[model samples]
Every structure is written in C-alpha cells, then in structure tokens.
Target: MLSDTSGGTSGFQWHVSGEGPTDNGVGSPQPEEEESASGVSDRRAKVTVIVLCYINLLNYMDRFTVAGVLPDIEQFFSISDGKSGLLQTVFICSYMFLAPLFGYLGDRCNRKSIMCVGIFFWSLVTLASSFIGKEHFWALLLTRGLVGVGEASYSTIAPTIIADLFVKETRTNMLSIFYFAIPVGSGMGYIVGSKVNDVAGDWHWALRVRLQHQTSHSECFFSELNVSLYFPLHFCCSPSFILSTFGFTTVAFVTGSLALWAPAFLFRAGVFTGEKQPCLKVPCDNSDSVIFGIITVVTGILGVASGVQASKKLRTRTSRADPLVCAAGLLLAAPFLYLSIMFAQASTVATYVFIFLGETFLSMNWAVVADMLLYVVIPTRRSTAEAFQIVLSHLLGDAISPYLIGVVSDSIKKSDSYMWEFRSLQMSLLLCSFVAVVGGAFFLATALFIEQDRHLAENYVPSGE
Candidate 1:
C-alpha cells in the first residue's frame, strides 16, 4: 500500500490511504487470518458506527442548543424572533461556506485530528455561551460561526471514514446508523436545554457561566488554546454502489432540506402555532413526545428490517448494484415532500401526518448517500469526496433554502395579509421540487451510464505508477 502522507500536517501525518488492495473491483483485500472475515467485519462496523454516532450526537447538540433555548435567549437579550433566527442563519452560512475549505483540508490532512480539534473548539464555544454579554452580539455570532467550522470538519470527514471502512453492500445501513444521530441528538439537545432552564431558572443557559465568572482573564486565555485528541485504531468496511446512486441521492438531499424548513416557515409566520406550551414541556408527558416515541420505535424497526432486506436484495442483483431502486426511492420521496410542506397548514392532523411522511421519505437518503459515497470514491479520497459532498449539499442546498425562505417571507411581510407571505414560502418549494426533479433525472442517467462493477469504475487504480 502506497500511503499518502502528502496531505497531512507537520508532526501529525496519517499513514492511511483511501484505496483498497485490489486493482480491479473484486473485493477489499484482507489479512492472512481472514479466511472467514465476517467476525472482523462486524467488529469494525460496530466500533465505527458507535464512534461516528457519538460524534454526530455531540455535533447536533452543539448545533441546535440555541434553538432549544431561543425563547429564553430572546427574553434575556431582548432580541426579536427574526433576529434570533439569524443565529441559525449565521451558523449555517459559515457552515456551508467553510465546508469546501474544510473538505479540501480534510482531503490533504489527518481527519481524526481535524475531528478532535473541531469538537473541542465547538464544545468550548458552546460553553462560552455563558460568559458573553448581550452587548457583545458580534462575539456570540463569531462563536457560532466558529462552531460551524468544527461541525463542517466532523460531518465532512466522519462519513468519509465510514465509507472507507465499510463495503458498498453495508454502506447504506451503516450510514443510516450514523444518521440516527440527527433526531436523537436534536431531540436530546432540546430536551436537555429546556429542562435545565426550567430547573435552574437561569435565563442564561451556559454550562460554563459560573466557572467563567470565577476564572481570571489570563486563565481563560490559556484554556482556550487547549486541544483534545481521540484517534481510533482499525477501519470499518463499506459496500459499493453505482454513480447513479450519488447523483440521485444528492438530488434527494437538496429537496429534503427545503422540506425540513417548510414547517418552520409556517411557524415563523405565525400561520400555524399549533399550541405553544411552556418551555418546560416534558419529553415523556407531552403528546408530541409520546407520538414521537411511537414513531421512533416503528421507524427503528422498519429501518433495521429494510437494511436486512437491502442486504438480501444485493445478493440477487445480477449487476450487484441496485441504483435503480435507489433512484426510485428519491423520485417517490420528492413528491411526498412537496405535498407535506404545501399542505402542512391544512389541518393539525394533516400537518402532522404530512410532516411524518416527509421525514420518512427524507430519511431514506441517509442510506442511499452513504452507499453512494462508499462505492463512488476510492478509500483514499473518500473523506475528500465526503467533504466536497458536504460542501455541495450545504452550499447549494439547506444553507441557502432557509435564508431564501426567510428572504421570501420578509419580502412579502408588508403584503395585505400573512397568508400572502406564506404563499411566497410555498412557492419556494417549487424551486426545491424542481431541483429534486432535475437531480433525479441526472441520477437515473448516471446510474445507466455507470459500469457493471459494484464499486464505481473511477475508483479502481492499478498499482505502482
């Protein structure tokens, strides 16, 4: 193996290269004690999944903690909802823009180091939330933006590592397991922040506030430079898929971002408040929570079962890659997403049902994209590709959609009625839907154009140039 350390940093070079042993797309080469490699495969997958899940969980927690405490923040800082929403916008804006830079770096650097440094930085900034004053608004925004840097680093590199480790057949299932971090982490962040505020009666929800107050300025300065490290040994494996999977998956990704913002747009316009509870709503007692739990359980079962089916389905494929099915899933999902956002305010029951349908369809992408990336990029460039994918997805996708929706909402704010403003938001989904439609077509074309190997042809490189 020709390990590429050319992209790594001084004194922190990594020995790992993204390429597998085979020059042809036969299979990942294994060690001599690997006649039966299933045991090692299971171990690698489980460990990688666990660590990636933890990274994702922490990533979402730091990302959405502000959203959870937005009301308290508004009350304490005397900021309006519109302005507070800018916090999210700022975070996402920096996140989207920096993703490419980070991707470029991750491609040429040690990803584990990047991930660790990023986690520490963001976690510290999250802690710094306790120290800053209301007048230092720009400082807070800067912290949020820096947090974006850390997040961009993790989200970009983690999946790439997963893909490098896993084979194509299991990549979707592996990625799905990784993505489970989103709902769990977001839900937990909200739960933690809301409950802590309720119990402590502190308008300031900073975990490090008391410590910050006690620490001297010099001490604080020193603490900020401290770095944390976590590097795991061994690698996981991913199954491969066709190029069509990547194209279709990306299309699904773009539309799904818009679908995610639909409800929030309605909430912002005050068109459908549903019922605003006190900030202290309990996770177990709340009706939404109960329903969410049932949904989670059912979805968990379905996801596992689907993964099982997919793995089985792969065995029967003459071509060994099921990208057609992947394309169909995305095509099916776009319409449901469009309908969900378009009709969310029709009725409470309708809103909830549609939103669930939207999310259910959107969730399928976790599997598809993982499989696509695992198969598409060679092991050495997987992280780079993943980072680029993140940059693309966020730069061209979610990062812009919310801000665009916000812009549309504000543009129509002076209209005679709020309904007109909401209509503008609704219209934006057409743009989202169109992207999905075009992306789907591109994906289908790419799928057809891809060669018969389970792994993408572009990945195979003969040795010893």
Candidate 2:
C-alpha cells in the first residue's frame, strides 16, 4: 500500500488512508476545549506543550545523568577512555536507527500513545541499569542502548505534534519552550545524578532516583515495539532542511563532546594546575560536572531565548531570518570555543567565561533549527523529517564525537600521566571549533534556499486522505 511519488515531492510517499491523525478530523472529536478552534484549542495546545516539555526534560535528564557520574562509573568498571565513550555511542546508535520507524508511525498513528509507550520502555531499562553489577559493564551498555527506543519515539513525534498545534510565531515560541528542556534537563541530569551519588555513596542511585516518576512508565515503551512491517524509506529535497541539519549536527557533535568530557576536562585542568588531585579513587570530584552543568543551563536559556528574539525581529527585514540567525550563532561560537579549550590549562576563570560564550552561541540553533524544519516541510512529513535529521545528525554528530574524541585522546597520550590525559583530551576537543565553523557555513548556505523551500511547503496539499 506504500508507493513512490511521480512529481516534485522527492522522497514523500503517497498518502495512506484508514489511519489519519486521530487528533484531527478523525473518529470522535476531543472535548470542546480540547478541540475548540482550528481543531486544537489554545488551552489544549498550551497544555500539550507543557506535557511534552516535561517528557522532554525527563528524557534529556536521564541521558546526561551518566555523564554526571562518569568518573564513578569509570572507576567502578575500570574502563579506558574508548570504552567510556562507548556508553554514549551505543545509546545514540540505537536511538538513531529506531527513529525512522517511530517517524513513520507518528504520521499515521495516535502521537500521545506512541510517546507514552516509548517513555515507559526507557524507564524500565533505566531501572534495570541501576541494578547491574560492576563486573557486568556490558549489561549496563545494553540497557543504555535499549533506553534509546523510548527517546527516539518521543523525539520524532513531539515536534511534529507541536507543528500541528500552532502556526507561525506561536509555534516558534512553543518550540523554543520545548527546547529549553535540552539544556535544563541536561543540566539537571548532571546536577541531580552527582548529588544523588554523593548522598548514596554509589553511582547506582542516580538511575534509581529517576524512577521516582515510574508511574509514567506504562505510557512510555509501547511505541518502540509497534509493528511497522514495511516502513518506506523517504528523503527531502529541501536544501534548507538538509543544510540546517548539517549545521545542527555540528551542534550535536560539540555538545556531546562537552556534555561527557567538559566536566572531566575541567577536573583534569584543575589537576594539571595543581588545584585538585587526580581521581585516584571512586566517586571522585563531581564538582566539575555540577559547575559545567550550571553553565550549560544558564547559557542554554540565554542562547535559545536570544536566538528566537533575534530571529523574530529579523523576520521583519528578511524572509531567510531563521537560517541567517543560525549561521551567525555558530560562526560566532567557533572562536569562543577555541578560546575556551586553550584557556583550560591556564586560567579556569578564563576557560569558563569562554565556555559560557561558546555554548550560549552554540545553543542558539536548537529551537530555530526545529522551527526551520517545521516550516520547510508539510505537516504529515514533519515526523519523518525530524527522524531523518536526528539520524543524520547523531550518526555523523554526537554518535561519533564522544568516541572519536576518546580514541584520538587515547592515540596521542604516551602514558597514564595526568598531564598526558589532560593534554590529549584538550587537543581532541579543539576540533569542535573547526566543526562549528563548518556548521555555520552550512546554515549560511541554507539561507540561500530557505525561502524557496518554505514557499513550496506553504502551498503543499496532500494527494489523499
């Protein structure tokens, strides 16, 4: 029942019937308030955004919590930098591959049900990961990888739902709010995980504490297991979507590296400067994770907020405002990132200030990029578009960055000396600056075709029900 397009739709499949959006003109409508106007009431839309944001927050928080306790886990498992990097790589790989199926279902299924099932799976895996023995490090990796199924389901579906609920400025604002979870949840993961570790004197507690919301589990894991027997592979010809995703991939690369390594790098910097001791034992200093997490939260808020405001204002002057703003953000971030890396060995204050500036600019793309994707594609394809973006970005971006940095660091380090460790990681991270510049260039190129793609999407109509 799935077939290819004969015209300009590129990778879009012919519309499928019998399973259109349940939230829209299908079956019994929702309540008067829930389906009030334009099939989505203002109150209901706001509530939906709030709920999605909460789920998003929990998702990111669960993900980065491991980073918060990386030192403890490393000590407990006795792993090398490359093996340490595998933790993130495995999770991302699973997430990336599972996204397409989730994307395909999101377009034709009940989005809420899909997300609930996904989250529940994630929670169960997380609960199990906490009980794993130190000797069973592979088990921990397996659970982390499985957790991706739930995340991929939610992530691929949520933004498209937001796109359906609102239009123009309202959608941009809501998307911005939803993306705040990226930084906030991420920061909380680090802050909460490390604090829990300190209190329980075991890294396992970090995973256990997230289960405080286990009541939400039954709603999470269903989407991951849904049978999509023949998922049609699709593509987008929109240059704006393609280029913006390339730019966003760089953001993922930089952020993923920083998320796992920034805290460790800072701790190592302290040791190199004679300000702190090397983590010779378990539960070593997580203060760096805490501090870096704080920076990530604060800068992320400022970055997303300012980028949205700037794009909103710039829209008055240019049709390509979103991509232009995205370009400016990454281009400006490159130098600050370089400064942050170079300053780490010298002044901690200088390193932090530069990191703040760098991350703030880097964060500017989160909501703007999503908004760009929503506008450049029609509603039905948004989920699939989101999935493609995620796969490409993570496959080329964060999925490899953490491991690549670790492998590069391991290759260059001549010994187990603290200085070599610090030097090796620092040098590997410097690659982020160049990557940022390349991302900016992609966004700059996106600006050229943004208007054309948006025009096509604006006039698009589904060939069937």
RMSD over all Cα atoms, model 1: 9.3
Instruction: State TM-scores per candidate.
Output: 0.69, 0.89
The residue-by-residue lDDT of candidate 2 on 86-198, one tens digit each, is 99999999999999899988766666677777877888889999999989999999999999998998899888777766778888999999999999899999999999999
> Among these predicted structures, which one has the highest lDDT?
2
Candidate 1, number of clashes = 16
Q: Ten consecutive residues with minimal summed lDDT in candidate 2?
A: 222-231
Model 1, 1-465: lDDT tens digits are 322233334222235345446747677664533211122344644665676777676666555555555555655565543465467667777876777676666656556666667666666676776667878877777777777876886787677655544555466566777777765655554455545656666635634332232222112111001111221111112223334433544553453343234324434334434343333222212234323333433443353345335635764863433455455545665676577556655655665565455445444445655665555555555554565556555555555554565565556555635465456556655565556566556556655544434343444653452
What lDDT would each prediction earn against the true structure? 0.52, 0.84
Number of the predicted model whose TM-score against the real structure is largest: 2
Cα lDDT, model 2, residue 238? 74
lDDT, candidate 1, equals 0.52
